[model samples]
Structure formats: structure tokens, C-alpha cells
Target: MELLLGQSETQVEYDRAGTIIKGQEVILPKRKHEDVHVNNHTSVWGLWWKDHQWAYKCCQQTIRNTYCTGSAGIEAAEAALDFIMKTY
Candidate 1:
């Protein structure tokens, strides 16, 4: 995904006076771990799946004054999957 550092071309409508903001786009790397057998004593660790890779970007805006906020690139894609699986 590409990161855009300016106001969105399309304005968002809001019911309240507060501004509607958009987060930056980020591309997270995909990772996979090897599985371990319960009977095998040689394996020190077990395989695990990560919801999303870690990536971050910073943004700044000037309204009455300049303000800053941090954003993560990875999408909230794992939320639904985790909820369905009942995983913490």
C-alpha cells in the first residue's frame, strides 16, 4: 500500500463538529513459523501465527497549529478471523 501525506481528496461527512481523519496505508510482511511436535523434546519453542506484521508511519497536520499522530501500516484484517476462532 502507498502512504499519502495530505488531506483526502474526498471529504468525509460528520454529524459532529469534530474532524474526520484517515489513517495512512501500510504494507506488512507475511511471516510463518514451523510447527513443533508435542512428543518431540528437541523443540524448544512452538509455532505461532501473527495477526499482522509490525510497521509504522508518522503524520503531522496543521490546523490552528501543527499537530502529530502516529499510525500503523498493517490493516485490521485479523480482527474478524480472531473473533470467529475465539482466540485471545
Candidate 2:
């Protein structure tokens, strides 16, 4: 599956103000024990934004917005998130 889909992935995180909360510097906990520490220190730790190439869905579905990937991975994500916050 990794071969077919490609092992490399693009993960990003940003703040509500469209500022960089975290980027490729993101570090994930390898085990459950590390989950707490890592999450607290990470930007994407506990946020609503889940998917990319799409708008983040709030509790209300009627307002589901749309987004596009940016040229730079982190910069693009921040811009998208910022737009969403402003528009929505």
C-alpha cells in the first residue's frame, strides 16, 4: 500500500490568524505514552481542520467551504486556514 500510495505524505498545521502554528517541524508520538506530550507541543494537536485540498467542516455542514493547495506546503495551508477563518 505504501508503494502504491507513496510513503511520503504532506502534513501541515496553522493557527486561526493564518499564522504558522506548526509546519514540517511537527513531531508525532510513536507510542500512546508520548501522545500527550507530543499533542500539547504540536499545532495540529487538537484542532478542527482535519483534511487538505478541501475546506474544514464546522459543526454546521451548510457552510462547508472549499480550499486549494498552495505552492509551499506550510505557507499554503496557513493561507487556506486564514481565508476560511475570515470568510467563514
Q: State the lDDT of candidate 1 residue by residue for 1-88, as single tens digits.
A: 2456654676455447655444433458554343322222222132212334221122211121122232221233344557878965
| Backbone clashes counted, model 2 | 0
State candidate 1's TM-score: 0.15
lDDT of 2 by residue, 58-87 (tens): 221112222222234456557778999999
Q: In terms of lDDT, which candidate is strongest? A: 2
| Model 1 residue pairs with clashes | none
In order, candidate lDDTs are 0.33, 0.43
Error of 1 at 22 (Å): 9.9
Per-prediction TM-score: 0.15, 0.21
lDDT of 2 at 16: 85
The CA root-mean-square deviation of candidate 1, after full C-alpha superposition on the true structure, stands at 23.8
User: What ranges in model 1 sit over 4 Å off?
Assistant: 1-8, 17-45, 48-88
The runs of at least 3 residues in candidate 2 whose Cα sits more than 4 Å from the true structure, single-residue gaps closed, are 1-71
